[model samples]
Target: MAVKITGSTGGWNCDFPRRQYMSPLFSAILLLLGLCLANAINFTTVYEWDKYDFVWPSGVNTSNEQIKWNVYFEYMAVFEERLFLSLEPFRGIPATLVWFPISGTSTAPPKLAPFPSWELHKKDNCDSIQAAKGMETDRDGRLWVLDQGSRNCSSKIWIFNLLNNDTTVRVHQFPDAVVSPSFDKRSLRDIVLDKTPDDNLAYLVDSKSENIIVYSRKTNKSWLVKTPGRKWVSLALSPIREERQLYLGKSGYKELYSASVTDCELKNEGRSAAVKLIGEWSYQPYRMLIDSSNVLYAAFFNQNYLCKWNISEPFREQRIHEVGEQDTDWPFTFALDTNGIFWMTERNDTGDWTKPRHKLLMAAVGARSYQFGTSTDLSLRG
Candidate 1:
């Protein structure tokens, strides 16, 4: 006998043959299968670091007196087998960028170190990093660094080619026009690279100014968009194919507004334009991840749950996993691998902000038994 199954509950239910249902052994086997399919999500702790484990660079003084000072790590990216981490300049520590191999032993995490001196210097100046928070690696083996320059330095984006001997390829400084007059300093938060076959673009978020700055590699020019009619205080961009969508979120607000990609062409002189509202969500997302299947995963700011929403019909949110305890520090920034696993950094919330505790974690969302629709995976290059 054949059975037909369909719905949002993962297509676990079916109309079985009447004779098969009557058999006790057959009924028991079916029950076990259903239970296994329901519990597909799993969370694992990949690496954990105590306050004393974070070692300072070779030149920096690691004496007991200096060790008392605090060090905080912000965003991270993975390319091949290497994991890159950015150290936020908190409590007088120099803003440093470092990376270590991911194949280290589980009992002992790899040591943290600064990026090579030759790659960091432009001409004669060394220690070019002021304050960096977000970074992304493209398919062409280039690592994009977003320096906020919150420490009185100029805001700039540094692109380094990792595949070709780790060479510094380009450095683009934000023009004065991109900085808003109302804010005392420019806060360049996150970066999203869109490398379509025809277009190469970078979308940088100005969280404090409520605008987005677009950079074109072909023209080597940058433009700013106000995102008219949308309150984009917590702006985030996720590009899928030719479509680049914007996600807006606020701290206390319970809703998220999304807009379609602006229609501005790269060849046009005026690259800035307004975006049209396409969708909205009931929960406020601090960080977002979309899979190959167009399934959206969100980590909330005020809540401790990791929520998943189906972009297709019946856009309902399902709380897949709980990340942390109530009113605690949760995953601030996260990245999704091609295999559908989430790599996130969890900071300590209870004690002093300087000596914050951190953990590198991984969560896997298993495949569903039901077919939702046709969708494609988001490429890191784009």
Candidate 2:
């Protein structure tokens, strides 16, 4: 499974000159870069974790067992040079949204601090994050979180202004008719943001409900597309707004599909958006994302490999690389930093549960995240 955007997603129009149509030269350059990334790139270990060491709030009642669990790191995003990770608020997890500066690299397990503050991560506060699986950051320095509220908290979308030192929070609680907190599980898994001068939109995957929920900032309302499948886990919008596409993948399926983001705007609560089959992979990609170059990257389920392809080309041409030597390296959350560094968190499935065996790794390939539009020559600026 490969994930990629066409380029031009809101907060992502920075990497290159925005164009309504991709020039032949631009496509060639993206192809070259994608090939360069497959040259057995050396991945550096920024830090590893066997147990998640969160900065526990002073007054919170957390059992010590919470830190040592084999809890998985689901999603990650980078903003303001800091890496943010979302830990699902499961049986013993304390915080769902946390971050640490990429500058201050620690040799020991990185100390994950609650974003904004510990106060904002208190479970069931309703005012805070209860459960989260996916998160994203934009060029404007805003952190967007999709909180799949537990039974105690209602599902809501949260936006924080990192530009203001994250002092402000804007939240939108989905109406129960479209989204209600589930006691058995969190339905909303992934979120993608599309921002432009004309409109601000968000697309999300409701796995259990089998729906694609579209929300608009302009209207301050949400609509649902009762999708055809049940496990719609992977999602992304084309980086180029003019050719916007919503790429999707399922947990067990090897094929990836896409739909037009515009077709999902219908106010019909039960409408189904038309989808097109993009392509398939030899292995199953459980999670994925795209880079500014329109290069789609995928992390296989419980596999030691990570693969990528220039979406402008055929899926058969995708370049797959073994990111690690360990069989336990189960890659999941991944995002590209501003400098073209590939960052991801991997779970050591066979490691000692008492220690921090999981690792956060980085590799440079001269590529930026799709959130940055496309590649550009900075010299052209001044």
Roughly what TM-score does model 2 have, to 2 decimal places? Answer: 0.80
* Top-lDDT candidate index: 2
TM-scores vs. true structure, each candidate: 0.73, 0.80
User: Distance (Å) between predicted and true CA of 178, model 2?
Assistant: 1.8
lDDT tens per residue, model 2, 219-272 = 778878866664586786666546767788865678788877655343346788
Which regions of candidate 1 deviate over 4 angstroms?
A: 1-40, 52-59, 64-69, 116-127, 180-183, 229-239, 242-244, 250-252, 265-273, 276-283, 326-330, 351-356, 365-382
RMSD of 1: 7.5
lDDT of 1 by residue, 1-382 (tens): 7343334334334454545445596664565456434533466767766553344546755665444335455566777777777765655454357776666566565666556442352321423766666677775778888776643456778888889867778877777787543225466666667665576677667656545677777777777766543334344455354555555554345566565554554224444444544445555665665554556666765565666666544556665655434345334556655444567666665555554366677776532101111234323223
